[model samples]
Target: MFMNLLRENKIVAGILTILRLYLGYAWFTAGLGKIQSGAFNASGFLGNAVANPVKGPDGSVVYAWYVKFLESFAIPNVDIFNFIVPWGETLVGLGLMLGCLTTAAAFFGLVMNFSFFLAGTVSHIPTDLFLGFIILAAGYNAGRIGLDRWVVPFIRKTVLKGKEPAKQHA
Candidate 1:
C-alpha cells in the first residue's frame, strides 16, 4: 500500500520536513522581530549608504550613482520594502513550514535570495541556503505528511493540468 511507501520514505521526507520547518521558523522570527521594532520607517539603504559612505575613487562614478539611487529610489520606498519584505518572508516561511506548494515557496524564496545576493555584502548565506532548499525540494515527495502532498496534486489538477512541476535536479 501507499502507506508502506510513505513510511519507508519517512527518512528523506523527515529531513526535508525538518529543514522546511526550521527555515520557516527562522524567517518568521526575523520578520516578526523586524515588525516589532520601530526601526521600520528609517531610510534603510539610503541611511546605510550615507552613514557608511561608499565613496568612489578618482574618476569612478559608481559610488555617486549608488548614492543617487539610494537617496532617490531606496529612501523613498524604505517603508514599503520594510513592510513588504518582512511579510513576504513571513509568508514564505509559513508556506514552507506547512509544506504547502513548497516548490513555489522555495522558488520565490530563491528569488529573494538572489535579489539580496545581488545587492551585495553578506548575501552568500542566503544564496547558499536558497540553493540547498531548492535541491531538497526538487523531485520526490519529501512532503508526504505535509500539506504539499495535497497542494501539489491539487495544483497539478487546477493549473499544470495534472502535471507536476519539474523537480529541480539531483
Candidate 2:
C-alpha cells in the first residue's frame, strides 16, 4: 500500500523529489570532497574495518566473510576502490539530481549505504537507506518531474523499435 503510493501518487512524487535532491546533494558533496582531497585512500579504512569487524551479540564476528573479503580482495585492490568510490558517488549524485536515472542512482546509493553499514559505520546509513529504498520503489515516477520523464520513453522506443509484436491482417 505504501509502495503503491510511492510509485503512483503525484503528491508523493513531489515529496520524493525533495528526498532525491537531498540524497543527491549529500552524495555529490562526499564524492567531491574525496576527489579534491588528492589523498583519499580506501586501504586504511578497509584495513580498519577488517581489524575491527562488526560483531554479533555473542561477541563473535558478525560478518566474517566481509572481513575476509576486505582483507583479501579490497585491500589488494584498494586502488580500484579509490577510483570507483569517488567517481561512482559523483555519477550517482548527478543521475539522481538530474532525475535522469533516478532508480539506478538510488540503487547504487543504497549499495554504498549498505557497504558502509557492513563496515560498521552506521551514521546516516539508516536514513539514507530508507530514503533510497523509497526512491527506488517509486521507479519512473521518482523522475517524472525530471529527465526520466523523457529519457525513459526515448530509450524504450529506441530499444524496442523492432521488438514489437507483429500486427495481423483482419
- Report every candidate's CA lDDT: 0.63, 0.88
Give the per-residue lDDT of model 1 (tens digit) for 92-116: 7777778777766676666666545
Best by TM-score: 2
Task: Give me the overall lDDT of model 2.
Answer: 0.88
Off-target runs (Cα >4 Å) in candidate 1 are 1-10, 49-72, 123-142, 164-170
Candidate 2 collision pairs? none
lDDT of 2 by residue, 71-96 (tens): 88999999999999998899889888
Deviating ranges (above 4 Å) for candidate 2: 162-170
Measured on C-alpha atoms, candidate 1 has an lDDT of: 0.63
